[model samples]
Target chain A: MYDFSADIADCAQAVEAALDAYLVPDRLSGPGPAAIRIIDAMRHGSLKGGKRLRPLLVRQAAAVFGVAPGQALTAGLAVEAIHCYSLIHDDLPAMDDDDLRRGRPTVHKAFDEATAILAGDALLTHAFALLADPACHPDPSVRIGLVTELALGSGVGGMVGGQMRDIEGEAGGFSGNDIAIMQAMKTGALIRASVRMGALLGKADPEALAALTLYAEAAGRAFQLADDILDVVATPEAMGKATGKDAAMGKQTRVSQLGLDGARAELDATIAEAIAALTPFGPPAEALRATARFFATRQS
Target chain B: MYDFSADIADCAQAVEAALDAYLVPDRLSGPGPAAIRIIDAMRHGSLKGGKRLRPLLVRQAAAVFGVAPGQALTAGLAVEAIHCYSLIHDDLPAMDDDDLRRGRPTVHKAFDEATAILAGDALLTHAFALLADPACHPDPSVRIGLVTELALGSGVGGMVGGQMRDIEGEAGGFSGNDIAIMQAMKTGALIRASVRMGALLGKADPEALAALTLYAEAAGRAFQLADDILDVVATPEAMGKATGKDAAMGKQTRVSQLGLDGARAELDATIAEAIAALTPFGPPAEALRATARFFATRQS
Candidate 1:
């Protein structure tokens, strides 16, 4: 079994450092006060603590392709910024209507709703700006690839699309297949982009991209299953956010569809599939496989 | 002196043709139903009839720089998409809460609030995708420049930022300087970008770019002042949308600050300044100058 306690901790620390440096106050200079506030709000959402799972996936995939860990920091930062923006918007009054996020007041709850909306908009727009910065990457092709990956992943066909389905699926019962589709998009898309971007940054070959994608998909599913189980079984204090809200809202979840035991079984199978997909990637993939196991079984 | 009816008719036709091509059954092929609905809603908002002023500015600026008109269409489409997205979001219940737009129900009123929000998100994301397409411009540098222009013009530093300030200024009194800053971003930024992108597409010199920026700034201010004048003088039927809503909402306006006659004088001076700025670009800039004149005095 992979030991995530140490490795994932290191990855999380690296992500935090990179994000702080990336979103430094100097980077947002020259814009007017309105623009500055938007940037500040984006930083507020992005710099807040999370597990940094997406950025970690990016770093590990880059490692598998022989990229130095430090060199992957910029790509990892860009992906995290996009993820952060999505979360800010998803928690808005018109969307998910959540007041707390990651154990603290959400951006909208901290700022006004309009400011939060604009902050999310600015963050999404700025993610592309960062990726397109030629100074950030030596290869133009890589920058283009990164932009395309991010656009497709967070755009209508990816995360946002998945979110729309999740909202739509709330009113009606969704099939297991439908639930899978939503999970793949609402959560899986960004996770998948993390690995794909890491491979592209490291100049990985076709085989490596395919393998990493499979690994990310399995890991993503396991993570969602774990979230579903936690939503039902964990307390708000333990989970750091509201629990059982999804079920109360009549949203379809693994626990609702598969029951607690079946959901736990599915999580185990997904963790195994994730690990199996990483077999061809060898030792560099060890950390990622361990991360998946940790995601599947974590209490919070 | 300028006849805008003919130009508006032609631009509307162009927009419709392009949108019809975009919305054909084939373009709707996607994984999820929610994605399809969001895209449909986006197309519905974006393709609807309007003056197409931004695209025309792009085309006219390109002509001034001697580039083929065809080169302006895609950029024109991209700008319109951004503009429409902004309008949709601005008209949301949390924002402007308008029921009618351009003689039709607003996107949020036509669809549900959630779909309207998602549609705006989809259009904004897709605008970059359209600009970045290889087919849109073979030169990577050109594509990058367009992306930068569009992103900056739409972000907090540009239109969205301006909208935020507009809201704030209305709720809380602003100084003249604050009003100018908001106008520069809210209206002037995209107008400046429309001309700048046109010049870039035409590969115009730095001198020409500078001239176009000046012209666009003056014209954009003139346009907004004319809008202020119209809101007081024109009826709802004549305006094709709700008028006088600004005053009702206690929003700041040129007329409010400078009086009606003073605002009219400012509009005239702004139009003259726009015309004078174009003198450096010679006769080819006449159409652009004429467009500005039309904006100042047009009934709609």
Candidate 2:
């Protein structure tokens, strides 16, 4: 009976507005104005369009602890910036080489490759700076904790490390378990970080934090599994980026490891597990439960 | 009486030792092991060679306020990591496109572009994580301040902005003033940040901090001017990387705006101004004064 579309849409709108403010092309970090070209590329890379799934996850996870949407948006914005920056780098010629992202030209294509690279680097730096800003958390200690979580989630043993592993896998290939590790690091880490960061922002106690962490881990797997299924079934037009490109690259994914039907079955089980992890909070976690369901059936 | 060469050597040795400890290939940020390929690439890019000039700057500047080299070393490592990561990205084929760094093949050339990109990303992220560590500063507030300084210094309006401007300069051409701004943003920002971060770690009073900022700005310009001179005059063998690269690519620098002799005179004046900024601290700031002179005269 729960409708998540409206809630997700509202969260996305708020996140995008905050991101727009953060992406000011002329904002000064020094005496001279910021490079308009790089800032534009950052805006282009981040502001255009996407599901804003990560920010929504942050909001929903925080809502479970009675945190208001306004209170969680800063952390949401920080996580979203990291996501956008990663996509920009991933689409570069040296990496995934995709020209399209969110159905528009990637940063490198919209600007120059050099601008795109600088934009990615700046956005990555900006994410940490945003976390340090008092608006993210009044307490410096809590802000530092958020910084640590986001850095590790997207950094070497997490997203970037996963990408490296997947790249290595491209050469040496991946086993079934390798696929899981790769997926966890590449995507799951950031997703998990988004949820955990939200709980941290709410000052969730250890028991609540543990419950949320478990929920996040399961939900991360569900989201990734659903993505693999979508990759196999969705079209570029529907997904807003090159679909089937991963498969075309012979990238071994969970879908490749467990056949398509098997992956879909796993996704359903994963979402159910994700929902079950929230059982301790019952109706207080309905938003997250609804989010888990939405992940499986999303068209884009 | 101030023979800086030996002091410089000792600082470099200590920094390299700490960097070696920090650059472990298997340090985990998550459940999965870090990608060995990316970690190896990080070590290759960061550990192989260089002056460790930035860290030494950090040490000397911190020492002005009686901060021990040991107290400043963690910050030294963080700033150096930023410097190294920038070098890795700057050398990418889509950017400066050099195949060499520190007398060795550049990261992209050695490992592949993908690994180089990931290594740079991870290192940049790791920098913030390092700043938040207890060893960096016992006070979370000061650590947060460090993160903000480093981020802004290397971010959109600073180093990355400068690089983007330089790239744009490639297509549009640069005026004399434009070259100065580019130099300030590209190389100047991070150098300035290194000095200020050192001062912050030492808890310099506002008046002392202002003096250090002025000194840092002058030193940054002197260092950039010297680097411009070296690019024109130094050999690839001596510099340990591609020399004459900016010129060959028609990249504009201060040396381009002011001819070689003019730039040499400016460098001397700049170093003098740097020294003048430290007059308030007198003997306490002698190390920083020595550092300013060293910047103007370094061969590589």
Candidate 3:
């Protein structure tokens, strides 16, 4: 009965606007040409449309606790900027070496490798600045907490660490458990932060925080499993990037480990668990519950 | 009549210890082996000794306001970590491509290029986290201020932007004024943050803040000029790395722009200006004045 698609669209538009406001390429402020180049790369990498799933999750979670849409939107944009940066870096020649992202030339391919690297670095740093700004939260503690959570999710202990493992796995062998932990770090950590940040901004009690965290963890796993399934089952045209790149690279994805059927089964189970975790909030959490269900079935 | 050599050494030790505490490679927390590898690279890049000039400047600035040594040291370490991260990235093949740093293999040389990149990213992220932590400052506003200052100093419009220009300048030709602006961003921004963060933690008044800002700007420019002079004159044995790199690459530096004698004159003038800026602080700023003098003349 509850649909998140419209809400997702609205949040994505707001986040895009916020990102534009945050990233005006000021030639007078520093090195003119260089600043333009990096800012262009940043905009190129970030502004192209995607699912905007993370920001939507932030909004949906916030909506559950009556947090201001504007406040939730700021946190969402910060997290999205970080996500955009990670994608840019991940597409670098030394990294995944992908030339296309979101149906266009990747940051490195569009600009240059050095610019891409610097753009990624800038975006990551700017994310913290956004969180730290007074506009993000009234209470400094909440702002500090946002910064801390984002750093933990996106830094060495989370996304970067998982990226390292993922790269290593290309050579490779990894147990399912090892892969699971890597997925948790690489994808789940940020997703968890995206969901929980809205809750934190809303000043959710400890019990609600724990429950939402569990829900986010389940939803994150489901999302990854669905991604693995799509990598094998979907066409490159449908996905907007190369499909089966994971298989080509010998990546030990869930689909490879558990097979398509098992992976789908796992995704369904996780989605069910995610929905169950929202029982405390009951009807008010319908949007979040709908988001969890959608994650396991999202086509592109 | 005050010498700050002992004070510098004491501050350096404290900063090093704090860096170690902040960068513990906890395998159980994230992607274990990959985390260890990146942490190793981070430690390798950061732990090996240098002059600790930035942290020392922070401490000296804080001392003027009687800020607690521990609080100053924490802020100092955060700035130092950013410095270390910059060095690691600058030494990458896509950037400066230096093999040795401070007489040891650069991070990319010690580890792989990917690990070096990730390590730099981790350190940069961790720096903001350090600034945002309550341990860094009891006041959340001060912590947020540190985060904002650092983000501005190190992001696209600051150090990274400056580095972009520096990299582009390799094919060669930048005006004297252009080099000055670039140098301010490339090196001076973080240095300014170092001085300002200490004073900020100490809650310096607006007038004092302005004076220290001027002093830091002059000192930073002077320090870079000294480095340029050293690059031309100091032996690799003394400098702990290859000398004449700027000349060999046809890179424009203060020395290249102004000639050796002229560069030295500028350094002297900047040092004098730095000292004059501290006239308001009087004897409380003795160590800072000594530091500015040291910047103009320190050898490898």
Candidate 4:
């Protein structure tokens, strides 16, 4: 069986390395002082530490399909960039209103709210730029597919839709099923895209694509369920950002709907289902299967 | 001479028709009431009344390059979507804080701030989705090129960069050159992209592309100068939205830097240069040339 924990760690490192190279001072050349500040703000938000799990999925799926990891780097970077932009915007004064992110001051707190907003906007647009860069991938079909995947995952039909439901649910009321739908769109879309994109780049067979989709969906749910449990159990320092904010906002969550223990049970079921879905791929998907387990049980 | 005024008007109408079709209520189908609300909010913000000038350029440029006008429709719609997204975000409380746009309530005023933000985010992402859709264009290279153009025009190196400069300039202290740079990025990038994207779609020769770029740059400057003039000379009713917001905010507009008459003279010169840049393209570019004149003189 492939060591999924080690594979994910390697994938994360690869994503971080590419991001570091892309956001290096030299890459932002030819702009005035204000532009430079905006670029700096973008780098500050994007380059800071994160798990890089989404990009890792992209890379790993590529590996399973026998494509070079480098082949998926640009798409991986683009996905992470979108993820970073979402985090920045979500932490804005009018959104989640968080002061911290990944153990550092959130973009709005580090810079001003206007700068943070602009920075987020810049990063979001830049993700497409990276994907479209001729130097990254010569095949236009691949580029187009990657772009569509990322956009749909991040847009109203996906993450934004999920966030809208989240906030609206807070204002109204929601059942467990409603919470699941919200989580699926908000977090599951990107997770599914990560695997799908990686498979696309590797040109994985139809069977593998279907299995990966199922794996990602279940893993995504497990990740969110774990998050709900963490919010209740993890301390501020341990969590690296504000915890328990979901409950404070009177928002619906797996924990809120199912209770902490119930949420944990759900997480276990999700992880098992995620792994089971990958059984069609046999030992080659062991890494993915392990990653699902890890997601369900991560301390942070 | 090609009658650019009539041609551009037709192109604009064609693009609007396609956009209207694409945004029909059926396209937003999915689970969750909140998701539907978000989708509706995005469609409302993006599909509301506007001149459709940016999308028209994409169509016109495509025509200039000899591509079928039908081939440019999706690309045109994509650009307009991006334009609408920017407007929605720019009107948010933390940004321009405007209550009105195009004589109607701004997205935030019509919806909540959070919903408006998500709508903008969704539209921006959806623009790319449209560009990348295989059904829209069979050529992946064309899609990739379009994505690149749109991204650069909208991101830090273009519109977002200009916005940052505008915000920073308002905090006080900037030279005339700084103001020019800001305007070029904020308004000029997308305008230039409109022309360039059209040329790209038409498969214009490199020389034609260069000429179109120059034309777009000049026209963009003239367009901004005209806006400055209108802000000073037009009333709220004449301008559609607030007329004097730029001056009130101490923005470094052409009218603020030069007297109103001086700004008018500059606009005239820029428009003349824009028209001159199109001379090499012969009668084929008459529509673009006329559009330049329209941009210079438009009151709103």
lDDT of 1 by residue, A93-205 (tens): 88889998878889988877877877777767767767767754677667767777777777777788888778778756687598888888888888888888888998888
lDDT of 2 at A124: 95
Tell me how large the interface RMSD of candidate 2 is.
1.3
TM-scores for candidates 1 onward, in order: 0.92, 0.97, 0.96, 0.95
Q: Per-residue lDDT of A52-148 in model 2, one digit per residue for the tens? A: 8888888888888888889889889889999999999999998889898888899899887888888999999999888888988899998898888
Best by DockQ: 2
Candidate 1's clash total is 0
Chain B alone: TM-score in each candidate? 0.94, 0.97, 0.95, 0.93
Assess each prediction's global lDDT (C-alpha) against the native: 0.79, 0.87, 0.83, 0.81
Best by lDDT: 2
- Using TM-score as the measure, what is the rank order of every candidate, best first? 2, 3, 4, 1
Worst ten in a row by lDDT for model 4 chain A: A25-34
Per-residue alpha-carbon lDDT of model 4 for B1-300, expressed as tens digits? 566657766776787677777764355332222387777777678664778888777777777767677888888888888889889999988888999888888988888988888888878887888888875567888778888888888887788888888887778668758888888888888988888888877777889889899999998898888888888889999777998877787766778778888988888999999999988877677667778889887867
Ranking by DockQ: 2, 4, 3, 1
In candidate 3, position B274 carries an lDDT of 90
**Candidate 2 docking category?**
medium
What candidate 1 gets wrong by more than 4 Å, as runs, is: A1-7, A10-26, A29-36, B1-8, B23-34
Pairs clashing within candidate 3: none
